[model samples]
Every structure is written in C-alpha cells, then in structure tokens.
Target: MHSQNNDKKIIKKFNESESLVINEFDKSGIISFAQKDVSNSFLRGTSNDFIEESTLYWTMKFNKYANDFFKKLTSDKYNFNQGMLKVFKNDMYEENNSKNYLLINSADDIKEMTNCHLIPILKNIIHAPKEDMGLLAESLVHMTLLKRKFSIDQEETVGGAIVVVIISKSDGFIWKEKKQYYSNESNKHLEYVNYYKSQ
Candidate 1:
C-alpha cells in the first residue's frame, strides 16, 4: 500500500493529467470518475458493474506501478531460463477425473504472454470458468518476478518451474506461496510460484 503522502501525490498527478478523476465515494472508498459511467449504465445495476469499474479504475491507476516493479525485478537477468506457463482444467467427474493441463510452451505463446498487458491477463483469470483454472493465470505473471528473485544456481535443481494459478469459486481470490521441487528421474526441477494470499 502507498503512504498517505504518496497517495496524495498520485491524486495530484491524476488531477494534473485530467485523464481521470478520483474522489471518495460516500465514505465507502475512493472511486474513479469512470465509475460514474458504469453507475449510469444499464447492467441491471448489478455488482458486476461495480466490479468492472473498480477493476478498470485500479488497473489504470496502478498499471505503471506493476510495470515498474516488473522492470526492476527483471532488469538484472534478462537471459535467465524461465519456466513454462501452464493452465489446468479440473473436471469434477467420476469416471474421467483426470486433470487436463495446457502447456503454454511455444516460443510465440511465451513471448505474447510475457509481453501482454497485465490488466487483461488478470481480468481473464478473475472471470475464467470453474473448470478453466483462470485462477492460475497469475502464476505465469509471477514466474517473471520469481526468476529474477531467485538465483540461477537455485533454479538448476528444478530444470525450470511451472507456474499455476488456482482460484476457488466460493472463497474469492487469494494468493499462496510458491512451491518448488526436483524430479530425480527426469533430472528436472519445478518451481510452482504463486502470490501470497492474506489469511
């Protein structure tokens, strides 16, 4: 979280830019001027409108922070080997209970994913189907950060890690610790990275 002074600075910057306006929303919290558009829209006045407005507002407000954090995190090791981003679909069935996983390992796929905008990536994860494992989308984003945090020597044991994001239907979104392990038979190591969800 940013300090009160920093928050004031951010507000001032936004005020100067005139691209958006932010103000407290009747003691609830600060809301963006863009939210007024949603409030007046015809989406049955549902919470979905609020969610979409909030997501867009915050994404716009904090996108630069996320990008700067990414840059600071990855500037030192541009050539490090990165783990593959994987998506899994969990089918809660009796007979065909096998978990199917999608391996996003192609060079083009990897490049596009790594370079894409963060907001859409997060929105996709947040709105993904129950079986689609959109919750795990964040793991892919964290892989870039983790690769820079941990040393190459430490990663050798895992041969590379697979980042998976998991979202629970009823519990809302939460972050969890990264899991790392090595497979002796395959001579590979895997780091399962995740965001730290508050308890």
Candidate 2:
C-alpha cells in the first residue's frame, strides 16, 4: 500500500542496516519484516529449511511480540503458546472461517462458517474501520495475548502460555517498540515485586 518512493526508501534503509527485507501483502495489510530483528533463540529446535524456518519464525514472532508487550504489565507467570495464538486468529478473529473480520472484503467468495466459537478479541474488529495498519496489528496481537493468558490459567499444557506482532510504519519507526534489555530488566524487577507482594 506504500508509494513506489516509500518502498524504495524502505529497501534503502534495510540495505544500509544489512537486513533482509521481506514484504508480504494480503487483504488486511502489508507485513514488512527484517530477518535480523528476529531472535535466534526463538528459532531453537525449529526446522532448518528456509520456508519452514520462516514460517516458524513468523509464528514465534507473534508469540514474542505478545510476550514483549506483557513483559512488565502483570504479575501472572505464563507464556502465549502457538496453539492459543492460532485459536486467537483462526477461531476468534475468524481468520480461517468466513473471513468477514477482515478489514477488506475483496475475496470472490467468503467461506461459510457453521460453528464459530465467537470469542471476543481484545479490540473489537467486527466492524473496524481501516485506516492505520499499526493499530490493526496491535489489536490482533493483544487478542492473542488475552487468549494465551486464558490458556495458561485454565489449559492443562505447561500449566500456562506465546505470540509476537510488530509494525514499522516508517523507516526506523517501530510501533510501541520496547528495547530488549529494558524488557528483561523490567521482567526481573516485576519478579521481585511479585515475590514481595505475595509475601
């Protein structure tokens, strides 16, 4: 959705930073990714094949973003798993169902959904107006976060929790960017606070 000049500028910036730029376009919006920004630790035990690795990275990024968002905001100890993230998008947001929750309805035919769970997303995307991609992305991420939290508190697996979402509206412009070290320190401090508060 960007102008040619803007695209050029993006490419130039990535070139300068020695980062691999990946641009994916869908009806919802464009996803621009920099390979370097993705953490290698998140790729642990994942496939080595390029396509498989990228798919895992994308999924992990969603988990990472959600985890990063809640790094210090809560006392709950849990993680957002990939299954919960999938349910958030596929079941709640109707990603794999009717696709009606999409910001743009350009498909030839929307899939007919018989039994939808209809779990409410953090931000109501039922009739969201399309203007800013960053807001849309953030809302989706938050929805995943909420789902993962529920899974951790109630679900059997891991007795827990993951999802990452990112957006860069402009060059060097990260949407709600939280530095890695800052998040780490905040999480540690919160651990101490949670211990003392519990005591």
What CA root-mean-square deviation does each model show from the true structure? 28.1, 25.3
Tens digits of lDDT, candidate 1, 15-47? 233223122232111122332222222211223
Candidate 2 lDDT, tens digit per residue, 103-135? Answer: 112111111110011112212333454324446
Q: What TM-score would every model get versus the actual structure?
A: 0.19, 0.21
Which pairs of residues clash in candidate 1, taking residues 3 or more apart in a chain or in different chains? 135-165, 136-165, 158-189, 159-189, 161-191, 175-197
Name the candidate that leads on TM-score: 2
User: In model 2, which regions exceed 4 Å deviation?
Assistant: 1-131, 152-199
Q: Report clashes for each candidate as comma-separated counts.
A: 6, 13
